[model samples]
Target: MTQAEANPRTMGQQETNLGLSRALPNGSGTEELVPSRYAVQVGEIEVLVISDGVLPLPTKMLGHNVEPKERAAWLDGMFLPPDAFDWSLNVVLVRSGGQTILVDAGLGLDPDLNLPRAGQVVRRLEAAGIDLASVTDVVLTHMHMDHIGGLLVEGVKDRLRPDLRIHVAAAEIRFWEAPDFTHVNMPPGFPDALRAAAKRFAAAYRSYLRPFDEEHEVAPGVTVRRTGGHTPGHSVVRLASGGDRLTFAGDAVFAVGFDHPDWHNGFEHDPEEAARVRIRLLRELADTGEQLVATHLPFPSVGRVAADGDAFRWVPVFWDY
Candidate 1:
């Protein structure tokens, strides 16, 4: 069963509903204090961490070739249910040199993907005082639905940010647009929906889309690096300014995968290549003491990779606020 189907109620239903009408000390009540956005700095650049929401992934699917008992035991040890694992949807907004750049568009304005918890990036961005119209550029880490869905606005099907230039890896665009490109072992209609979304994004933003086949700097300190594996042309963003640097490792390492870099996630097209990329990236990040911003590693997802024996660990950056 899908996560949404298993839960029936959308993600965060209880938390949102519980705080909706609760009486507050101010007596006005009706205030829901949920975490939606966070802000961080990389030298002079400003980054706002906006949350699309959360989706529950099946535990078994996260681990490859592992016994059911092993997965259950690991979850139990971590004080979590064995059935579902929480997956966060995070995107970053970079403000530098008067340019407002969004890292990855979230699940857009629609919830048709059955991930009711997601599709809140636009709303959250507004709440955080970010003007979508002022966004100058959008950098897509991959053509995945959740990452690129928000590139287009709902209803009108126009570009979300009217004047923003969309940036993507040329290899990624080619891979997704290929006739033979197909999803393996995914759910029914999932593959078609993903392909359609990619095609739609390419078609809609063709005029402003900039596909980079080689490493290129989008801004003064932001560069896109080819890091394919999860997808044929998956890429990661690197930000360097003054003396600080951070890597936006999109989909490279999840929470569990942080410690178990060898595990093959079911979502990877080439599990071996994905594992290799994760391990090497994690090791480099850890050894060099660079910051990392991952899309799915919990809310306000900024952290550092750490060496843990032969494996690795994730150390979340302290909340600045």
Candidate 2:
């Protein structure tokens, strides 16, 4: 039975109730927290990252230059409205040639966090007319709960069938699953949630992970590129077809204002390393004409990065339907 049907409460619910409709030019909206976007089709290759929901955070989540006045000035500089910071978690799905790929599942709900909005990725996928079980391969960018939490269904594990090989960066899994060093205080700007998420995801990974390297063909037209630093083993994926290439840049770029390459998100485990990788990746992104599909770049987060003086900004260009 489909995962949705497996649920006892909404056995006969209508499609719209499941958030299966496009809300804007390139957005997928749900009645959840805030509306979000889903990306599908990268130059003829079907690509999408279903949204789970928004992580409510304080505004200015990414610390700009010090000084209170300067911070507000920075916010004003970016045209940010009031004190606001949040990220929309995205679950990716890529369809290249004939192969179907799902990258980073969303957070699956449980008894404790009976949040209705959680676990909506599959429903969003269905709204887009994509089936969950048909997924041929699942490649995790990292083992964060926000990223890998959607792998299993509510209660039934056996029915959560994925017919393809699961790929993970060898180092990525080892690092997250390694013995925890929680006593020492972490650095400023470090993301503690990621550490807890690692613990949660590691439990699931014990049964599902398979090793992958820096450069590997995940499927017929998809390639896994190690981007590292954000998470010790984080990797970005490239989807190509019809002479065109699109990179599912994952958390390589966070929410909107922080979209600038120099602006790193507050949730990075290692800020310096994350910044270094972000700059380098942005450089490569700018060099290649390939389009970029980011998980948190304001939904349907597909775009291109270009150098602007010392930093880089995304130039959105998603046209496929």
Candidate 3:
């Protein structure tokens, strides 16, 4: 049955599969309130998963390398909507060594994609009792809107946290600065707007921008590993403390990566490189048994990678309510 058929009141119903209404819900006219923050301890440090919101991506936009039948079968077996992919937006809050660090900024305070479901990072943080001033650092996985969008809050950057420092990949900065860097799949003016936004953000936060390349520690227990493909400087972060280890895969892989590691999304700058990075990262995570914190996985996006023979599977961490 179609989404409209399932929820007769299309206007009031929360069609998570369709665009525009993904953040709001349907039924009773009463909004559903669920906890947007999840906390876990990495040794002595506290790690929180702050939800910006979710985006209902068209299924056709993902897994472009897979055969139509195979992709359909996989979606069917997973009991997912065939028409749209429910993608989650998650950012990490890390408090360690007396410092508060955020993995990615999320959609900031504005929805650059024009999707209402996004741009909830600040709200989620506030709900979690975290103040913007408390965050000392923000590490960008890449320069995408969904990731770096939260670096500034429209006109309230100083009010939010003027002292906050930003950590980004050197290659990512270079890619965005280039004259021809653009997303073929984005809207006509989206790329230009993004570039403009980047310039604006950098101008305001230039003193705080800390660019790095190769593998190195960004914080006391957090290190970023360069994994290009999804973007020129896309990277995955690793948090290690005591004997515990967790890897924030960023956009290196999404939920579909579990079953289709070789499949590439249409938005990737280099589809081949993206697939390669996903496969290599998946294998390492599976072999090492490290917990994964993905940006585009389900909410409370913490999981483990399990090796399914030659393929891989995403096993969401068990949450005890």
Candidate 4:
């Protein structure tokens, strides 16, 4: 039985407290009322999903290819604002085979971007009792600023071990050299910001990069496989041990993907291929009945996929407390 099942009253009270806390002013020094990290045990491997924070983006970004009215209808059906919504930024930490692997670094400080709510991975990790120096390997899904910017934070590299390995797709590293932004439909200033961030990340950690052609095993039960859709070298990390399985789908899947898998997201470099990749991954997960976690899904985005008619469904797992 789950914690809520065992003590529903306590759970309800906790929820009430959280609701009240949300009214408090920001930076009030009160302990965070909302959960920022969640833990899951996949067989013997340990996994933790940390919330880097949320990104407020335009609603058009969700599906640039669809009609505005169609998008608005969907948003209205979900009771969300038609103008904008917050996208959760999730980062995963895995421990297996005596190595601790950080799946993707959250967005670090980018003052010009005006996204101050993000870039909390460092502080959240510390609060979770994880030291930056403990991370042995970092498996990047792509070179997007949100995925690699945390490592570029001031003094972060100095705190990390000198021998840290950052595994990324070779195609990804090369694409960033001269990225093509013609296909993407991002907000103003995003293209320049992404380019500058990727450049800075490459220069800052050139010696630590471990580029891979297709797939690489960072530790036992942890393998990152290149998918090449959202970006030239986008990838997803698969974890399997003792019959338990999970997939950390970087940008291939989004919240609206289940209802409209073919919609093109504004951030996708190759929207067509991205939709294909999303459909393929969703089908696979539905067939296998394994857990799925993604970067942009809601916080603690631990869930399973289910085939629904011509589309798919997201069945979030009960929180384990």
Best-fitting candidate, measured by lDDT? 4
Q: Quick one: best TM-score, which candidate?
A: 4
| lDDT tens digits by residue: candidate 3, 1-321 | 111221223412112211112223442212437656666666655677778888667776667777788888888998998988668899988766777788998866544456787778876665444667777888889877778777667754654576677888889888877624433454355566667767766677778888998776877888888899888889998999888888988999877788788877756778788889999999999998988988988888788899998789888877733
**Residues 209-243 of candidate 1: C-alpha lDDT, one tens digit per residue:** 88898687889899988888888778899888778
| Candidate order by decreasing lDDT | 4, 3, 1, 2
Cα error of candidate 4 at position 191, Å: 0.3
Candidate 4 local Cα displacement, residue 215, angstroms? 0.9
Q: Between candidates 1 and 2, which one is better according to lDDT? A: 1
Per-model CA lDDT versus the true structure = 0.73, 0.62, 0.73, 0.88
Residue 31 in model 2: lDDT? 43
Error of 2 at 191 (Å): 7.2
Q: What is the model-wide C-alpha lDDT for candidate 3?
A: 0.73
Question: For model 3, which pairs clash?
Answer: 14-26, 108-150
Ten residues in sequence with the least summed lDDT for candidate 3: 13-22
Model 3 Cα RMSD, 1 decimal: 9.1
Cα deviation in Å at residue 170, candidate 4?
0.3
Indicate whether candidate 1 or candidate 2 has the larger TM-score. 1
lDDT of 1 at 275: 83
lDDT of 4: 0.88
